[model samples]
Target: MSKRVLDVGNCGPDFSSIKAFLTKNFDCTLDQAHGMEDSLAALREGNFDLVLINRKLDRDYSDGIEILREIKADAVLKDIPVMLITNHAEHQDAAMELGAKRGFGKLEFGNPETLEKLQPILG
Candidate 1:
């Protein structure tokens, strides 16, 4: 079975890396929704094992935190792992408490240790 990964990104290189990583590690298929509305629409129609949300959106839209809350509130999507990937360090603890499996900063995005850190949760 193919696991699905969703990226709520603003057309960045991060999406490419994430797609590559999941393809290499989990043989997963990736689909991305660019912003708040797109992400929500994608959630309604697709099934994902993991989700990556950028903390800040490109335009004036709902931030990752609000998206996190919406995902958790949905009975069907609540169990799927949602990760907040950001440059901000301050949101880590709050994200963990808000039902994200983990919060990863941009600096660590491609680090060797990053995959190791995610192994326990994503493996």
Candidate 2:
């Protein structure tokens, strides 16, 4: 079966590349949830192998650390791998400390936030 990815950024050109790449490279199914709460709710109700979280969100919420904390705190969702996509490598240490599988800079993803490096983690 195709692996499931919870993309928390919704639909946008900025994220379109990653979405397209995920399908093209991994042949995975992506379920896009627009907000923090929605993504959290989905995690509670369903099972997802990984989560690709964008640096920003629909609202003014760009804080992925707290969300990462909450996810790790949850018994059911703690094991789900979470990857943070950002333009700053500075967040790498902090995010990893909070249980994020990894953090990537916008440039790291090149034209998209999807990278082959994600294969092992998501696989």
lDDT, residue 74, candidate 2: 90
Q: lDDT of each prediction vs. the true structure?
A: 0.76, 0.74
- Cα displacement (angstroms), candidate 1, residue 87, comes to 3.2
Candidate 1 on 1-123: residue-level lDDT in tens? Answer: 667778886455767876776677765788987776788788888877788887876456557788888888889878888888786767866778889876677677567777776665456
Instruction: Note the residue pairs that clash in candidate 2.
Output: none
* lDDT (10s digit) by residue, model 2, range 1-123: 788888776347656766776777775887877776888999888878888777666456677666777889998899999987776677766788888976675566554444655878655
Model 2 lowest lDDT segment of ten: 105-114
Candidate 2 segments whose C-alpha is farther than 4 A from its true place? 110-116
Error of 2 at 47 (Å): 1.5
Deviation in Å, model 1, residue 104 alpha carbon: 1.3
C-alpha-based local distance difference test score of model 2: 0.74
User: Candidate 1: deviation at residue 36, Å?
Assistant: 2.3
